[model samples]
Target: MADTYPWQDELWRQLAGREQHAHAYLLHGPAGIGKRAFAERLLALLLCRSPQNLEACGKCKACLLLAAGTHPDAFALEPEEADKAIKVDQVRDLVGFVTQTAQLSGRKLVLVEPVEAMNLNAANALLKSLEEPAGNTVLLLISHQPSRLLPTVKSRCVQLACPVPDEAVGLRWLAQALPGLSDEERGELLALAAGSPLSAARLQEQGVREQRALVVEGVKKLLKQQQGPSQLAEGWNAIPLLLLFNWFCEWAHLVLRYQLSKDEQGLGAADMRKVVQYLADKSEQARLLALQDWLLEQRQKVLAKGNLNRVLLLEALLVKWASLPGQG
Candidate 1:
């Protein structure tokens, strides 16, 4: 069974309590907020031969089949490789599946995760199935970045915006999810994950805190002239490029914010507060703004999965960052 989150209780009630289900639903939210799990739970309920209290009956034949990944009336479409586009051919296959009669004579269901992974051609192909709904077929489309989706595709489905839990709620859940970590540690993780609790848990598992500490130390050293950009860039080879970019982008934002507001409380995480303040005091706003612009441009390339020379990119970013402190 898909794990039901505490934060999703209201959303589940609203969705499951519907008298007539829509032919398609677009569940859009930030990544790691359990939208996929919510869709899975809904799919199970829709497939269950006998549901109790707006939930799937665990003992039912349909539930058993789904648990075993052998559901004849259900299909899940995703990229064959992680972070790759869902090919047009794959959508074509799904279109064929959409037209077929369900073996169980029940509602046919299809789940597509991160729907923005489909490029223009693939998305266009999916429109065929969306336009002509076959008998008792329901499609669940999940997207982390709905802005990338075609307007026509967005128009065809019932759009449900998933919620991001507040800090207190997230911390409460993190307490259970990561009992081994101290409250402060979990809080830092949550902050690092940008308030996405599941993402915080995932970052903990991925050793993101450790990587962040290393990067933080390196940044301090770079500013102090103790470490060169090339050395630090090569040393950080194990860390993910996107993660690095995100942290730098965030730090740049913090520096700018502090420079403008002089709000010490807005210095962000404790580990980098001093560094952020130092940069804010010493760096010219114009230089910081230009650096942020460059960071955003490069971040886009990172997101698009362009063929980037990671070491070179990191070196470039560090060189620019290292130059920030003495600019004023």
Candidate 2:
């Protein structure tokens, strides 16, 4: 298709000025912040045989090949399966491609989305190519968890944090992609999106939107109840850890907004005021931060081979959240 990059003018300008750009670039950021799009656009810029000023000339042979997904010099690698790590064989496959001449005799674009998904052997296997890459073959390494990548992998090239777009930008973009949504629907979607147009777009799908709303409503209900944390935790233990992360942050955002506005906009109608207020008065922001770390630790623990009682973990979180006020 046409090459129209919206949010990355300066990076293009910088790349244009460089006489010898680095071969590897690590694009790291939170999910759906347009890192993938940035990588794709940068790939086009690198492969474009001809460009008008800083933008890729979409009509060129290289651009057309990219559009058609037939660019022999370009490749993309991600985890071959969900929850299955990338093994050494996968990384080793890149060796021949990295060593060989580019199909266009110009630039080869090798993009690895979530380079952190690579196991140790796979990561080390890819090291030689990063150390002695073929002439002008760019490796755009994209990772949500870049810290998992070896320091050697990170040290070799540019690392850029692609932040989320502004709400208005995301809203406008999402509106065009997600038609038939009311202004209210769009607004809620924008809040749920957390400045991510991609996420807002995904929320347009019927089942997903309904599911998100259900989860939010469920969490709201959970937060308002009178039972002890342990008892209250029993009813809803099946929600994904990430979903818990999402809803808790949303609830906290609502409370913070309520604190700021003292209006309907900030109010959590689910009557979570006492619990949230209790935490706000007693807990440091670090305690709030610890929620994510604790959740992740549990996720990895479960992922690696451990069975955690879901209700108990949720109870522990609530009790920790409850008791945070007195910590030194």
Candidate 3:
């Protein structure tokens, strides 16, 4: 994959310019920042027979093999299913691969993406390969949440941190990626993505703005006692649990900001200003803080794969929110 975002130029140069590369590199960054794409480019460049200007020559045999997903010198390990753990058996297969000699004359490359998904056994199983890698072999691990990885695993690789790009750079890139979007829409998407251009583009593609509008509308009805918590929760079953909780968490924080600073700017969402103001005026500050804390806890639980009833959880949360005005 070519450098999809211009902000990655400096990191790409640093990786490409290195003459003596590490045996293993851990690319750690927030989600949707193109860490995997960067790793893929590095893999192709390492395996290319005739690289030019620190880039792989696309016509080379190795490049063609990589493009076709049949490269003899390359291996990629990922979860068997999305949002699932990388099993120990998968890592065991990688251990076997690393022991063998490279079929190609160049470097052998292994890529394990979102390495945090590895369970204890899977992580421990890969330790031996990392400890004593084969000659001319390179391992690249991409992790969105490095804090969750084993300390032993982290110590075995050179750490590379990818930062979120500047806001101006992110907006400019977003405009180019989504030329059809209005400036306001692009800004909203950027804010929603927390300034990650690639993520902002994805949010736009997923129509998160439209979904958020519906959610906000539902919230308004609930707050007015015109809608039941259970009914609203049932209607919102189509939205992902984590996403819905995250959105509510954001809204709660915005309400808190409005209460504290009386500054509407912290809301970030232009469309939600009126509701935010109303909530700030009607809700007790202490209770809002408690709800915010609870929402954060729930969001983290959902992300950690907690076993909870989503519909009931949502219903309970909405019930609390609907009672906020009365409590104050």
Segments in model 3 whose C-alpha atoms lie over 4 Å from true places: 1-3
For all candidates in order, the CA lDDT equals 0.93, 0.69, 0.86
> Candidate 2's residue-wise lDDT over 247-307, tens digit each?
6655565545544565654555334556555555555666566764665576566543346
TM-score of each predicted structure versus truth: 0.97, 0.74, 0.93
Per-residue lDDT of model 1, residues 1-328, tens digit only: 8998988999999999987998999999988889999999999999999999999998888999999999999999999999888999999989988989988836899999879999899999999788677888999999998988999999999999999999999999999999999999999998998889999999999999999999999999999899998999999999999999999999999999999999999999999999999999999899999999999999988887789999999999999998897721
Q: What are the per-residue Cα lDDT tens digits for candidate 3 across 128-172?
A: 889888768899999988988999999999999986888888888
Clashing pairs in 1: none
| Most lDDT-accurate candidate | 1
Worst 10-residue lDDT window, candidate 2: 1-10
- At residue 127, what lDDT does model 1 achieve? 91
Better of 2 and 3 by TM-score: 3
